[model samples]
Target chain A: MIDWFQKLGRSSLALFERLGRGGLFLMRVFAAIPSLVPRPRLVIIQLYSVGVLSMMLIVISGLNVGMVLGLQGYNTLVDFGAEESLGQVVALSLVRELGPVVAALLFAGRAGSALTAEIGLMKATEQLSGMEMMAVDPMKRVIVPRFIAAIISMPLLAAMFSAMGILGGYFVGVGLLGVDSGAFWSQMQGKVDFYEDIMNGLVKSVVFGFVAAWIAVFEGYDAVPTTEGVSRATTRTVVHTAFAVLGLDFILTALMFGSV
Target chain B: MIQKRTQEIAVGVFVAVGLAALVMLAMKVSNLSSLSDQDGFEVIARFENIGGLKERAPVTVAGVRIGRVKTVIYDDKSYDALVTLSIAAKHNQLPEDTSASILTAGLLGEQYIALEPGGAETMLKSGGEIKLTQSAFILEQMVGQFLFNKAAEGTGESKAAEGAGP
Candidate 1:
């Protein structure tokens, strides 16, 4: 019993240590925000790498997901003799939930992992220490731009995903299934509420972007300067980002759609 | 300098695409396109029950949509749902005595208000109250009543006689 109690206490301490470190790192990022403002060029470059580079993955995933949704939604709606409502189902599912969630997941995998790997590699090369030796704050020069770029890009990527998803749904529903395009669009227009569906998804994506970027950069910056450590940090960035996105999604959905 | 210019162009394209996506999302989600009924006049309708009736539900006349539901308010005094509709100006020729009924698009699809014109000379002005309104069809209650009636019939005339046993 004593041995078991000792193990539990040690694990709990480690967990608290990680949480405290993460909180402090977040505070440092916040402190370094002004450094990013005067340097639009840095932010723009990071945005291109993080946001623009991730576009292809987001669009492809969104299209496939929406196509599948169209197929499945059409089948289900047909059973109720309401196949005309395929557009509403497709648009609702994408705008309210899947677009944000899928974009975040893809963003974590493509951009977040890349951020972690790049930063981790820099740390492994003693470049971060080199910057410190040169009297430069690596947090401002290195981390803040990437952080700000990521946060800005996410909602935009999510919107693109939603738009492409709608198009994919249209192709499947209207082209293949022969659903009346006019009815499909009109029905969707009538049913979907702007504030409730679209804005809610945007808000979710923004929160997710902040969390994912924070995890990616922090894990990278804090990684031990070793090959194994860099790889582990990259992996952890993806894993942690996925968990954070899903957890935040559930809470946001509850807050947005639930009777709160 | 050329490299910087190229990078700036790429960033410009990226920002432009992002803005396009934003506009598309906003238009689709909010119905903010040219087709949206921005300039519309208000009208009121009262119903005993507005089951599954939501704000922004279409108000159609003879299957052509002319307006959208603006709001749904419950009047405690009469226990009626007072639905306000914002109709496009082009559909301003509806008679004052026009009747409105809540109808489903498909059998189990969304519900909307269907207006039927009456043979009245005077047209309804903006903000006119549509006095004749039918409530939405409650499928569950209808099904329950149907089952009850079927069970009663299965038991024959004895159940009916028992109910009239005064």
Candidate 2:
């Protein structure tokens, strides 16, 4: 009983320690924000790696997800003789839920992992230590740019995903299913409110981006300076980011959509 | 790194594409493009019950959309629902005696305001009250009234039979 009690206490302490450390790291990154503006070049490079490279993945996933939604939504809505609302059903689902959540998950798996690995490898190689020795704060030179790139790229990527998904739905819903193209578009426009649906979705994606990026960088920076530690940190970044995105998505959806 | 120029161009393209997608979403998929800032005249319509009539619900004339509901509020003095409609300036020729009715699109769908043009020479101006207004049809209320009428008829029939026997 004592051993079990001791283990639980130790683990809880470690978790709290990690939380505090992550909080401090986030503050430091925020402090480095003004310094990042002058060095757009660094951020651009990071954006190319994290954002540009992830585009193909986001777009493809969005298209496929949208197509599936169209197919399933049509099958269900047709029973009610509401096939014309396929576009509205698909668009609302994508914009309000799937777009941000799925995009963020994909981003976490792709860019988040890459960020963690890249930074972890740098730490393991003592590159961060070397920079610190030269009086260069690696937080500013290294972490801030990548972090900012993640934040900037996320909402844009999510938007693209939603747009692509809507097209995919259109292709399947109107093109394949012979649903009237005019009805499809008009119904969607009539139902999906800009402020309530799309804007709220954008807000969700931004929050997801902030949380995912913060988790990725923190996991990497906190990684032990060893090869095994780097690998573990990369895995943790993806896992942590996934959990954070999903959990935060629920909270955000409730806050944004919940009438209560 | 391939080249600084190449990297910047790629990033720029990515940003551009993402932004374009967002614009498409806002304009095509959503109703943002249809949301115009043109000046419009406001008209108030009083209804016994608004039902599911919401703000931003399309206000149509002869099945063609010309404006939107600006507000739905309770008029404590009149003990009725007051709906404010913003009709587009181009549709300013609507007659002052026009009748507004709360209508549903389908058996069960969103409710909107429909205007039937009245045979009048004067046009409705801003802040004008539409005297002829109809409340939304409530399915449950109708069903309840129907059941109540049936029960009352059944009782009346039994009472009539008893009097005839006596």
Candidate 3:
């Protein structure tokens, strides 16, 4: 029994070590600068696909989340005769914890998976190897444009999400719920600090963007150049990047707010 | 190519409608609420504990927002929570002997100041202080006290049973 337990522990350690090495490799890929400049056409395509295309989903998700939070918060506050505090509850929750993190997760699932699949297909077809033979850098030709696009898109998406969410909360909390609209706005304006929560959310999005792009690209590039391998790589990239984004969010929250 | 173009247009229209709805909602919310301004009349309150109390938390009296908390500063000399409240012009008639308490809206909710007006004839002025204040009632402390009391009762019951058995 003891021997079996010891073997299990060793296997777990090995698994963690492999995951750590993979993460480091992805980070290095992100840090590497390409010799050739990314083409404007590629950048535009990436921007459109990742940013503009993502707007509807982000807005829909953000609005619903806001409405739910408002309803739940109002219900709880009504018990204590503090129904008016719903504005602060909704605004603070949206700005601090939900807005950036949820947006990042959504982006990772959608754009991040698409990126993985595209690159994975190229690798399976030996296009990446062919480009290398032609003295063209695959990372420059492919990864950099996507990386830049993801970084640029994430902050904009997060900002849009936060704005929509606050509006949604207001509609449900004040308009439908019969709470005075003036009171809600006043409470929200007084409590929310743009510098502290909003700026922090934007900064977190940049970091998440880098992590999501890097992981997807790395997984796609290192895939076994087979059809089955490409599919597996795409799936793994989305799952791993999503979990990593959530984990990093917790770490950043703890570091930023723990001492306070 | 034509089909793709039409599909793209449809998606664009959908997104535009969604964005418009969100904007309309925002305008409605903004128009409805009134926030207290800084440089207004101030009132000070004391609290033992203020959990998750942000600097700009609203100070309400009987569900009406009369003011906002300007700052939450700890006075070393007094060893108490010195909360500075910024009251609106309309609510400037708060009595001098009004009681202030640190209250929480819900379980694990944000903390705020709840002002209970007193019957004093003299109204508080700018930079005046509220003398009577109650601190936040911590749920954990209450639960701990209850458990301790229950344990004491249990011990007393066991002691009586032991004596009767002898």
Q: Which candidate is the best by TM-score?
A: 2
How well docked is model 3, in DockQ terms? 0.08
Higher lDDT: candidate 2 or 3?
A: 2
Q: Which stretches of candidate 1 lie over 4 Å from their true place?
A: B34-39, B121-123, B140-166
Which tens-of-lDDT digit does each residue in A1-260 have in candidate 1?
Answer: 99999999999998899889999999999998987777789999999899888988888888998899999999998998788888899988999899889999999999999999999999999898899999999999899999999999999999889989988999999999999999889778766777778788889989999999999999999888899999999999999999999998999999999972
The list of candidate 2 runs beyond 4 A from truth reads B147-166
Please give the range of 10 consecutive residues that has the lowest summed lDDT in model 1 chain A: A189-198
Per-residue lDDT tens digits of candidate 3, residues A5-61? Answer: 999999999778867976776665556544324455555557667777787888889
TM-scores of the candidates in the order shown: 0.89, 0.95, 0.64
Clashing pairs in 2: none
Which of candidates 2 and 3 is the stronger one according to TM-score?
2
Reproduced native contacts, each prediction: 0.53, 0.92, 0.02
How good is chain A of candidate 1, measured by TM-score? Answer: 0.98
Candidate that scores best on DockQ? 2
